[model samples]
Target: MTTSDIDESVRAELDRLRSSIDNIDAAVVHMLAERFKCTQQVGHLKAQHHLPPADPAREARQIARLRQLAESAKLDPAFAEKLLNFIIAEVIRHHEQIADQPGERP
Candidate 1:
């Protein structure tokens, strides 16, 4: 193929890959939002029960479960662990914020 033709092919493939990534990003954002919502509810429940804000043991369990799932899916366990850790941290922080707010019960 001519140089221009090869360049066009590569560009097309890159565009396709980008589109897929965009979809994945959207899904991740949606799932994170859902996670935060659930965590907020949990925070409320914990507040009502007069429990502490952080649940280190539960968080560790969740990380372990996520790591297992990633392994089963044939993905990189380390990458999965890191990503889940980040997400979990964010969720926990949001939960704590919700719990600490004066007006809210959780």
Candidate 2:
């Protein structure tokens, strides 16, 4: 169990896997940044048009779509839905703050 006891090959394999995981984590963060940029634009557009911050119908559709995609990807659908819901909540919060500002024009 200890690092000192593990075989050299096993240590190398663990290092390789950890490196790949680190790379994947970085990519996920970058992708999330891009996603938020798009959602920021959406928030501005909604704020400009006097629209509601949260769209339940669209959210439902998105959850369903993501669930299907999760199934296709062999990921847990419930976990994907939960993650999307959390992201949607954050996006809605951002939209609400954008809507509150009166002077900024989108």
Candidate 3:
């Protein structure tokens, strides 16, 4: 094939790969939204029960479990841990907010 034809072929493949990545990104956002919705309810319950916003034991277990999963999937364990930490931080923030609201007691 000519050089110009090879360049066009490469561009086409890259575009296809990018399109798949975009779709995966959208799926990840939607999944996170769903997960946060569930966590919101948990936060409200915790607030009513006067439980602490952060659970260190659960967080530790989750980090370890996710790291294992990432390794098994051939992805970077550190990256997975960072992502989970970010999500956990947001969840704790929401829980704290719930706890601060008045009339949370049962």
Residue-pair clashes per candidate, as listed?
2, 0, 0
Model 2 agreement with the true structure over 49-92: per-residue lDDT tens digits = 88999999999999999999999999999999999999999999
Off by over 4 Å in 1: 1-6
Clashing pairs in 1: 44-106, 99-106
* Residue-level lDDT for 13 in candidate 2: 99
Q: Candidate 1 on 1-106: residue-level lDDT in tens? A: 6656677779899889999999999998898788778887888888767777778898889888988999999998889989978877777677677778886663
**Would you estimate the TM-scores of all the predictions?**
0.81, 0.95, 0.90
- Return whichever of 1 and 2 wins on TM-score: 2
lDDT of candidate 1? 0.82
**How much lDDT does each candidate structure score?**
0.82, 0.95, 0.95
**Best by the TM-score measure:** 2
